[model samples]
Target: MKPANKFRADTIRRLIVFLFLFSAAIVGFGCSQPILESNECIEARDPVKRFYSFHFGNEMLASKENIEKRKKYLSKRLNAELNDRSDTKFDYFTQTADYPKAFRAGKCDSTAGDRVKFEVLLFWRTNEKNSQRAIQVEMVKENSRWLIDRVESKE
Candidate 1:
């Protein structure tokens, strides 16, 4: 083969490999984002998350309508999660804590649209004599972000 032809062939080969790897990386990157984003944006603005922090005197957890800013974010989780257990006995304490320890997340599934489940960790420092446990929060995605739908004390 002529020198020019050999160089062109090698260039084409390199381009093909680059394109394939680039395409695969893009696809792989795209696939993981939705899952990470759903949880991140939600956790960043989750109502229960707000509630957890508010107890720390964050004030941003207030659900009062006049405070449109905070209320707006709360609306997402409030409407979906609150309504379901609104009538049930719930603790609405507003106590400040030393800090929110690291949270642990469990299995999460979001293949189906409109509804998805997320296991998250949230902690609070209480003056109670008993040991403080990591609270397991079950969140549901309502508008592209997860919302705390249910909460349980994880043993």
Candidate 2:
């Protein structure tokens, strides 16, 4: 019945509601997008979806099988570099965030069906929310397929 306790309870309730809403939005996003599973895209488009996996949080793309299409145009270092950065660890994250209006942006590259460039705004929280908007990736078309050429963003 203290004022501070009431405020804390209200805050916690709001946070819980926000988390539920956020989770529903993410699930809706996954179901709504036309983008196929990462591997299917890679096999059909070959190199295009590998980097797509990188920027958008797909794990299966770091394999040699997915990257083989790049060997002709890109150096061996490309695969090695991506492989090195690939995280096989299963980390857990909580959605202590509000859904961002500009969290991600991209267009399907007109030249290639599977290539997409994403300008993503990533949020990180320590105690307070911090947001940064940056060009996360530019997936390009080569040899009639798509591949992520770079992933970079400025906060």
Candidate 3:
């Protein structure tokens, strides 16, 4: 081919390769990060969701052992409170002896600087019964990490 045609062909090939790599990078990043949720919302919700996942998966109970294992997710005050309570029958986090089968962290509401709350939906399923409950989970950002500060039933 002529010199000009060869040069144009090489430029087009380079452009195509760059576009392909750029598209792949965008897609990879999109898959890794939350598309709709803000960073603050995600930071607040993650600990609560992780805690509940552990809570519900372990026989729907938060025993002392489980609490110890998941203490990093809890605030210092909340952790102490759970440890101080003498009663083993009641769970302070769920505020009930009967636990739900599954849970979801809903939209986050910023309460104050370094603090937010999530409306967590708890779901129960049985052969004859299907029920749900909403709970308010307050989280505080401590040392650049979100921790569950308190939980209250909205019933």
Candidate 4:
């Protein structure tokens, strides 16, 4: 083979290898990218999670002061209704007098207009026994912010 032709062949082979590596890198980068959640889902899910974190961390008490502290996460009507409850023994949010030790908010469902629902799991630890309950949390987008509208037992 001629020297010039051999040089051209070597260059072509290197170029092919480089192009294959570049294409593989591009494909690998694309696949490794994280899947992003929709803004609406984030907006809907964050407030619920934040509220539960605050609630559980605050000794799971739903007193008037605690309710007032978390008023930002509550709807106007719900806040008013909760405030009106004279008996602090019964927690309106958890719908139980005996509160759970912790809670987790599930995925947000935004099929309803301006409303999202989350399946919240409530956990209780008592005397080496553990119990859990599922509740449906309904939130409404009010004034461009998501707020807890209502809670119902899934049972």
Candidate 5:
């Protein structure tokens, strides 16, 4: 065989091998990504997530506007008047915690399969110190969507 032809064939084989390994690596990484469960756990955790995101003291736990927007995710028992508003703001220089610091779901207690409970962790920092809270969220199914009915800080 000619030397030039031999060199071209060797180069082609190396290119093929590299392409195969690259494709395999991509597939391997994609498969290893975490899969989120589509269950009461996620349903119960989502609202508490939003509440935690807005917990800068300047934000109200339940404002008239937020309550309306989150109404679908709240149980009627907790859908009462919105009177927890305050002008006080704990504007932090920086928020060090990542979202969904942690969460866990418990089995439903209602016979109708309408109620569920879960807990979520949140972190905040003021100039004085850092604080962590585990909030218990009670959720109920309304119109086929999970909604938060009650929330209390386990602090």
Candidate 6:
């Protein structure tokens, strides 16, 4: 083939390869995190779903690192509600060594007055029928952002 034609072909191949890789990277990052809406109200409609997606979407619940990270995050969110004076920490995660394969958002209710309050119930299935569990997620608006102030597993 002609040298000019060969050069053009090589450049086109490189450009196509670069575009493919760039698109793949973008898709991979988008999947890694939950997409949240700027409208806190819309996102607040299902705090449990959001919680599950952000907190328990990847690692097993029993993983110490995961548990500690979740606990710290919750504690930070609740500190304001605790008036920055409480040493107590709250947790709302189910603890089973068994890994959770799937979860579905259940019923949810919210109240609007000053700081909006949302209670979201989430259900998950592990390996045992007895493993069915519900989590109650409590959220309040802070600085125009929806924050999960507390979470408690409904025993």
Please tell me which predicted candidate would have the highest lDDT against the true structure: 4
- lDDT measured at residue 13 in model 3 versus the true structure, 0 to 100: 100
**What overall lDDT goes with each candidate model?**
0.49, 0.46, 0.81, 0.84, 0.54, 0.55
lDDT of 4 by residue, 48-130 (tens): 89898887777546678878888998999899988887646767778788988888887667756688888898889999899
When sorted by TM-score, best at the front, the candidate numbers are: 4, 3, 5, 6, 1, 2
**Model 5: colliding residue pairs:** 73-147, 73-148
| Candidate order, lDDT descending | 4, 3, 6, 5, 1, 2
Q: Which residue runs does candidate 4 get wrong by more than 4 Å?
A: 1-38
lDDT of 1 by residue, 9-73 (tens): 99999999999999999999888744454544345345545544544454423243323433333
Can you tell me which runs of candidate 2 are displaced by over 4 Å? 1-77, 80-103, 106-117
lDDT of 5: 0.54
Specify the highest-TM-score model's number: 4
Model 5 TM-score on a 0 to 1 scale: 0.50
lDDT of 6 at 8: 100
lDDT of 6 by residue, 28-93 (tens): 997896644335446665544565676656554333455555543343556534443322233334
RMSD of 4: 3.3
lDDT of 3 by residue, 97-118 (tens): 8877788888788878788888
Q: Pairing residues by index, what is the TM-score of model 3?
A: 0.71
Model 1 TM-score, 2 decimals: 0.34
